[model samples]
Target chain A: MRNSIITILKKELKRVFLDRKLAFAVFIMPGLTIAIIYSLMGGMIEKLDDDAHEHITVVQTINMPHDFRLAAEALYGTGMIIEENEPTEKDKAVQKVISGDSDVLLVFDENFIGDNREGLPGVTRYANSIKDFSIRGGYMADSVLESMRKNILSERLGGVDEATVFTINREDVAKTEEKAGKAISMLLPMLLTVFLFAGAMQVGMDTIAGEKERGTIATMLLTPVKRSHIAIGKMLSLAIVSLASCLSSLAGVLISLPFSNTMFGGGFNFSDLAYGVSDFLLLIVQMVAMALSFVSIICLISALAKNIKEAGGYIAPAYMVILVMSMSTMFMQPEGVWSYMLPIYGNILSIKNILMFKYTHTSGLISLASTILFASVLAWLMVRAFYSERIMKSS
Target chain B: MIEVKNISKTFKLSKKQRTLDGTKNKFKIAVENITFKAKPGEIYGLLGPNGAGKTTVLRCIATLIKPDKGSIIVDGSSVLEDSREVRSKLCLLTNELKVDPNFTAEYLFGFFGRLYGMNDSEILKRKKILFEEFGIDEFADVKTSDMSSGMKQKLSIAISLVHDPKVIIFDEPTNGLDVITARAVTDYLKKLRGEGKTVIISTHIMTVAEKLCDRIGLIIEGGIAAEGTLNELLEKTGAADLDDAFFSIYKKTRENVS
Candidate 1:
């Protein structure tokens, strides 16, 4: 059985990797696509971070309170090179925010300082756009007003401690570097799912459908080998190719780890993220199961299709369904029994859970087993189709 | 040796129009109770027109398709019970000549040799013999897509016979070949027969059938109209040659229908 599968795998690999165009699709193009995507993402993130930290021109209107001005200078002094401009009216300031001349505008009401003992009326914050800086300015303005109110209360209480009057404690909830590494790890399963599905479909569809289209399959059918052997051989070959594609894509993803950390602000240690021996074995099993399921589905479609064009038409919907399922793992938590029972959905969800360090061994194993079972049934259907008189007669 | 016994096949076409619902369409009989045998060292020809089921019969004998009725036996092994065993004993040369453009002739030869369960050394030995025999030794390393149709056809035939199956089935072997290539193919088939292998060939060309087939089966409308030696068929139809004899049998059948 091992020998037969190896033979089939060799043939499949030859079919995919040896064909210059197919080789490009399987190996080179995918890596290039990953690199391009990562670069674009990294560039966008850098641009956004730069915009957040860069200096901005502010036109203060309505005579900002002394305390508010001091607060603004202190906040903007860190990285923002704030430039003061002539005071503009509130409506004009709003208009200026739209014209892109100023990155932010702060307006204080005329009786703002006089009402320092009490809460002040609303302060209008504006910008050419509602950008991150403008939002940060609003927060800064609110903090300044709150500090003035606390001072006024302390004065009224004759030097009593401000802690009894009011207090606010802020705790940082941002993920640490280790937790951030874990967060990025959540994408591993999704990447694996997408690559495996894509590889299997690409290779499997070509194996059966392309052969049929080229008229080589009919000649092959004339061989004395059992139809089952051919089906197994082709499936095994597709699985190997699919696995290689998945591994290559993984490598591409890993290569961009530093960029991913820089873009997303994480300190992910590559060594920490490496799979152990047992985990690696489990990953292989899961990937094989996924690859087999995909190959089985494609082979069945190929058997049903009259030619490669027809096979492609059939495969489009299958791809859409699997794509949607893979993406769904991103939005939902895989805790329910249903998520562990569906084929591609279950497998992807289980893999996602595993990558996130969620204890989902049972679910993952079940998903793997069910996918293999489904693939087996589909493989049988393909074998039966091969044995059918109609297919041979049509040929 | 290969035996096809009383095999029949029918295909049902689904109605295309909704308005024709509930109306029963006739089932098309591709092969009806057709039977023949090929002994070792003999070339058996199945002569027929288009849609006469010659290829279908050959496919059945190759065990590519299961017959709706009856059975086929290759070297005393049942096609249904032991298809793999039967397959190991035969090689099928189909009409369509397609080769993977990526693989060189030598690679494909080695690949198919291994597929037939030939060991590494055996495959290498067979590859050498086939490349030399087909005079494609120089071009063995050239990609198949770069080869001409004649070269591709030669490679296809060589690949089929690489394992030296006892039974060889060739369906319209010279369908698209030029005169020289066609002559080369027919000469090769003659050589195969001479080497004590059972050869079953399906063709419409009467001259090629007459020159090559030791015995011929004339198939019409999915059934064998007659089967005999060249002289026997000529004498039976009271005609001078195979073509005249074929026309006489066809004319008699058409007249009987009228």
Candidate 2:
């Protein structure tokens, strides 16, 4: 049995890898292309950030309050250029912002600063939301006005310090770690699962359905080997291929990290990622299980189809369903053991837990065991399809 | 020796196939109660037109499919009970046996040879002979996609013969080949018969049947309309040749059915 499977695996891998064009298209190009594209996107983001600082235009700031002036000066210390323009009519100031010539238009009321204020002091900010720089400038102006309001409130409250009302200290290491972990969990599992499925679908359809379409499957089936051996051999090869492709895609995502960090203003330090070897080993194990399950799904669908086109039609819906399932994890509450019993959903939750460093041994084992069971069932169905005369002859 | 007894097969036609057939009947009787025998050292030909159940019978004999209500025995092994044993004893070829576009002939030959449990040296030995016999040695290393159709056909024939099975079966062996390549295949069939291997083929080519088959079976409408040697069929139908003999048998069978 082992010999038969090895023989079949050798043949399939040879056909896939020896063809230079197919090897490049399926295995190499996806990762390399994605890495290059994301890197370029990161570069564009960095350029936009640099250009945003020069775009702070503050109109009609001659009567700005003392507290607002102090806040605006602090912004200048941080390298923001808050240019005070000539006092213009309200309509013209708004028009300049609308035309993208300026980032913000601030109009203060005539009784803006007074000893006895009758009406509530008001400031109107006109900024185009469609422009990122204008939006940033608008947010900065709002912060300055908020600081002035806080100062007025302190004076009204008999010299109580404004900062004493609410002191937000976010220097706790555990809390910060949890926040980072939550963010990573919300996004990475969905991305990883989608990438693994995409990688599997790219090659798995051709493994069986393509052979059936070309009539070469008959040649393989006529051999004296058992049908189960053929199914196992094909599924194993597909899993390995898909896992490698997913890793390549992951490498693409990782290679673009530094640029993305600078672009998004996260300033995450790569050296601060304190995951140990065991953590990665666990992640690798989960990824392999996830990949096997995905490959089994693709192979079963491919086996049921009469040709590659039919397999493609079947695969599109499966991809959409898996994508939706993976996306559901972003909002899914960490439920009890029952949630780990679902198929794709369970695998995804397990991956999320592992990445966030919040997985329990019981939940992890159940999820992994469930995934392996599901994969085994799918593999069995594929073997049954292999033995079916109707499926083989229709091809 | 190959013995097929009361072999019958029925296919449930899909909606599309039924529409093409212009009938509401959901079943198509491909082969019904068809039986024949082929002895060693003889070339037996099944002569029939398209959709005459010839390929179905061949598939049944090769154990690629089982009959609906019958049994087949090849080399004293039951096809239903011991298909694996049957597969080891015979090789089946049809136009549907396509070459993988990526691999070369040499690669496929070695691959199938190993599956049949032959070691590297034995596979190389058989490959050398078969390639030489089919005149495929010159282009054996070329990828199948780059080869011409005739060359691919030759390569397929060589690959099928790689295991040196005792029985060989083919459906429409020369359907799409140039005369030269077709002749090479027919010549190899004769050689296999000379080496005391039982060979069965299905074709509608009268000249091929009359020239090559020691015995011929005329199949019509999923049944064997007549079975005998060329001279016996010719005499029984009082026709000039096998073509006229086939027409006479076809007309008699159709009239009786109606």
Best candidate (score: DockQ) = 2
DockQ of model 1 vs. true complex: 0.53
What TM-score does chain B of candidate 1 reach?
0.93
Model 1: how far residue A111 lies from native, Å: 2.6
lDDT of each: 0.76, 0.83
Best by TM-score: 2
lDDT for A247 (candidate 2): 83
- Candidate 2: residue A319 Cα off by (Å): 1.4
Model 2 lDDT per residue over A150-218, tens place: 667777786656535766776656645555565566767887898889877877888899989999888
Q: Each model's DockQ?
A: 0.53, 0.77
